[model samples]
Target: MTTPKPRHLETPTETTERERCEQWTDQLFRTSPMVRFMAKHLSLLDCNPLSPFPSASASSSSTSCSSCSSTNPAPAPASAPGQQPKLVIAPCPPSIAGGFSPSLPNEPTSHSSILLCSNRIFSKSHLEDTLSHEMVHWFDHCRFLVDWSNLRHHACSEIRAASLSGDCGFAREFKRRNYAFKLQHQNCVKRRAVLSILANPACNGDKQKAERTVDEVFESCFGDTRPFDEVNNPRLNFKATDEAVY
Candidate 1:
């Protein structure tokens, strides 16, 4: 006979935090141009990302993809088809801000969802940043047929996410004490990608291995920004004028 592990419960404070975070996350998903754009693009794709990870497919964009432009632009996308991925609020390990999870092969009907850490997120900005970061992973999975189980593939996505999600903006990079002006953005992206990749169980907490994986795909992955036109332009501006038409 085996005893089941005790179930942990959220205290009042934790529950309040969770609810607050969940509400904000919902609002962000609704109002964030970046999130909405990616969601719309994912919906336009024909494949199911959770359906046992298919071989790499050709990327697709709709006729209205350029609608995200504000002087600059995102790829053109026209209309919608599939269901939007869900944004789930749940407890996460202290070290993790959030995670992107794809349903197992056995659950063909299920799709990938993003999990936001209620306790770890301190403000709306943090929540937006976390959500945007995870969305990049989701976008890559749907558009590129990424095998999340593969370390190199995982590292590439992480690098692309961190690089393209506005996670390494100048101020944030400066705060991290990476003062070298030369290649600061690239360095910040690589360092953050390594941290994220190391969190994966497959890396076994091996920093060196994680760094190596990130390096191998850094050039190509960092340069490949899809669903968006460029880095630092996640199209987070949710203003009505900037919003992409679905």
Candidate 2:
């Protein structure tokens, strides 16, 4: 039997969170029809990445997608032709990461990773929400080879992640009993989008630049949800306060 690629976790909790990540990620991928569609097109490379074969070429030995990312992955290919890319779920420094599609420089691995900050508190529900949010980035990278450095592209993915991940739903607020502010859900998303955007190195801790980028792409990215119909969307009324978003 082919071995599943090894998942890398940066902390001692790696053993535990590995299972948790798989459980959460797989469950979401299975149940969400839109997520399922994205996965089919992804042809997610599951490989024995941690250990390399001696005979393998450098390109095949590592998980590099820069070459493969030139085009959209074919739907349901029986087998992808390159070295399988592992799905690395790891603990990241809160200042620089939460979860994202990163191109690791030193390793030159093409595999994608989602790094959750271990220093912060995380409930199961919170973790699931994070996974869902970052998965959009992964989907965008897989399909569009998105350049995270581009503030506009990053903001667009952030928009879709916030709007589609159910992060701005009233039901979530009701559950948390956090209804003190007007337009609480949308504002919460905007706040989160800003935070995520600020984490990008390009922001250099400039909150204004991050917020401005979010504002510029907010409507377009928030409105565009390919592979998903509107019925599955959250009740987000961003258009009304478009002028007042700042």
Best by lDDT: 1
lDDT of 2 by residue, 1-246 (tens): 122234442345655654565455445443544434344434443212222222322221122221222123211211234433344344445453256645544433235655544333255455545655666666666556677888888888887887766666666667657775786756766777898888789889899999999889887776676435542442222111112111
lDDT string, candidate 1, 62-181, tens digits: 122223333322322323443232444555677777888865655432266566777788887777777778877876776666787788999999888887676777766676676788
User: Each model's TM-score, in the order given?
Assistant: 0.72, 0.60
lDDT at 41 for candidate 2?
A: 33
- Model 1 whole-model lDDT (C-alpha atoms): 0.63
- Show the lowest summed lDDT stretch of 10 residues, model 1: 56-65
Model 1 regions lying over 4 Å from their true place: 1-9, 46-85, 106-110, 235-246
Q: Local distance difference test, per candidate?
A: 0.63, 0.52
The regions of model 2 sitting more than 4 angstroms off are 1-14, 26-37, 44-85, 93-98, 103-110, 116-124, 171-182, 231-246
- Clashing pairs in model 2? 63-110, 64-110
